[model samples]
Target: MDHAPRAPRRPAAPGSPPGGDERVRGAHPHAEPGAESDPDRAGGFPRPRRLPERQTVRDQVLGALRGALLSGELCPGAVYSAPALAERFGVSATPVREAMQLLAREGAVEAMPNKGFRVAERSSRDMAELAEVRALLEVPVVLRMARTLPAARWEQLRPLADATVAAAAQGDRAVYAESDRAFHRALLELSGNRQLVAVADELHRRAQWPVTEDHGCARPGAAPARGTSARLVTDATQHAALLEALAGGDLAAVESLVRGHVCGT
Candidate 1:
């Protein structure tokens, strides 16, 4: 049978908006069709949409604090007042205080009766303990998933892994931390155990909290190495190696990789 000639493709006019199969920038990949038309469905998986007025303030404040903590801007031993943070973030003190209360509950910060919140300091022992807990919970689950989950699942997760590498290469500590979290969380979620994922996530966050002492050392008040971004680049390599080990069903290698990652040599 004869076929009609396909039309030549043409470039969009400058300043024209995307249409007809061109994805809108930042559109959620997992959103169901027509989700944009429904207010209730505007939010994407893993992140909430613009929240209600009251909740939006809390979210913004909390997010800002979390970023500061992960990026080492809020060092251990620093006492930060809610008003100061509010001024920094251009928000009200109430939301900042509310956010600090949540962080206190998470053990990321401590409430000071008259003074505001102080970043919680972790000892080497504390980090070691956190790593032990993480290993006890996460290692077996990940090994099992490595053996049972179809290879396609690992393939599907490559983008998240790549995101970690990209974030690390950019040397953005907060972005790397978040992308790293998403990579691990996506891996653990494959086990279909919500409670395990939740507990493991908390342990992960606690382990990453700023330490008063150098990692793996007894000395108090030691600083983290200046090569943190370089270390993350190494970590990205390990993440790729881990995927290879998993794809090969090497349980021993998987366990070793998991332990090294959790313990942070």
Candidate 2:
């Protein structure tokens, strides 16, 4: 009998978005088919979708502050004036401070000694290092999933992959990031190892910002320039092939494809 690999342990009930719970650019909300929901545009080009309206001052304050950080509007090492942001948001310093605290938790900003908070800065070296880690950890985890999981798990993840592809085509990095994450975690479930999954979770979350999620752009001569377009085509193609390999139980191919696809070498 071909023994199916059982999940090593119970997996976390897939629930809610990772890290910051609310929707924002580059922040994936509950995984759905609409991360790149704009009506007009080709794939790999993300339409500029408006952020959600905040139902509370706290949400608004956090939303604005987070936006400023991610868009490169706020430079690293620049001390943020909470009072000013509070004023700008038309709220009190309390909410702004709360928002800052939240950003610090996400590693998007660092708390300074006398300067309140500054946007987190990663050097090119840091980026490369993180990318290496992502290549190392995620590719293997995904390959294992491709090699192991049962049909039901693949069924659960297909919509996510499809959604991510759409999100990438539309250039909605946040939604694309989230759906991409969902697909990975769903794949990780095949390992049945909770600890690996948790580590994989944080690893993917950290790399979310700098990824080349431009599936619509990762073509041989058509990849998008800068980070505006996600470099998704290569990864997407590799992933799609891996999925097909999984369906067919091609372990050697999963191993080889994932490494070259993610490492680019």
Candidate 3:
């Protein structure tokens, strides 16, 4: 769905207008019976308050926990204990449990048979599968965006790409992950379908294990031959090629390059 447009800003009434001092019936009631009162309303400004029907506390907790998992702050082989999370997030255990259950449904965390939720583990095979899935979904999106999106928006990606390169140069894995995520998001946004963009986002989130593994890109269980991303010049070259394809609007080459780059990486 298209985003709702923001309401037009009301013209400022000459300056700092206060509340509740409108000239009701053309008489200055606040002034002593007959004196000219300040036209600006005073005494009735609305106070800010929480809405009863806004997102539940559990939802907020769930979002925070998911963000933590995605950012690699909460490593695999760790437990997401409700009481502990509650203490961390300044909420009650009830909301924490609800949030953990939500994360479990999304496969970000797993409920242990005997206890709390554990950070879900992804093996080398899982990484390979995720890379394949990402390639399938993202490559075409970039191709399409390159073909149809405004040149202005396409140009906007250069800074994001530069940031990614800088992060890589400095070995700032965290910044690198974010800039990489932003660059792809901009590409996917050009698809002009919120639903499709959301689908790609979910895929990106799931593929994070393989793409930017915090515990180390390839561990004991991972292998280079399983179609998982390579960690050398191949990765850099593929990304450069992907960027070039986008720059050139090579729609036909988009899918294959994306697949090759991701799988190559």
**Whose TM-score is greatest here?**
1
- Over all chains combined, what TM-score does candidate 2 have? 0.59
1-265 per-residue lDDT for model 2 (tens digits): 8999985754433563554344444535443455456464324356677899748777777766644443344556567778867766788888888888887887877787756787666665555676688678766676666655675666656776676677667554554556677777777767888888888777666655442222122222332322344465445555566677777778787777766654544
Cα RMSD for predicted model 3: 14.3
Give the alpha carbon lDDT tens digit for every residue of 1-265 in model 1. Answer: 9999998766665544555355566567677777776666654544356856555789878887887776566777778898988888898899999999999989999999889999888888888999999999998889888878877777777888888898888776667778888898998998999999898888887777757764222123343223267888888767777888888888899999988988886
**lDDT tens readout by residue for model 3, 1-265:** 8999998865545433465333445443444542434243323323355668889999888767765665456668777578877987898999989888877876778887657889888777787887788777776667667777655665666666665565555443344455566766766777778887877767666665433343542343333112212343234344556666666777666677777756644
Name the runs in model 1 displaced over 4 angstroms. Answer: 1-55, 214-227
TM-score of each: 0.74, 0.59, 0.58
Better of 2 and 3 by lDDT: 3
Provide the clash count, candidate 2.
Answer: 14
* lDDT score, candidate 3: 0.64
Question: RMSD, each candidate, Å?
Answer: 16.2, 22.7, 14.3
Query: For model 2, what is the alpha-carbon lDDT of residue 93?
Result: 88
Would you list the rank order by TM-score, best first?
1, 2, 3
Worst 10 residues of 1 by lDDT: 215-224
lDDT of each: 0.80, 0.63, 0.64
Would you give me the overall lDDT of model 2? Answer: 0.63
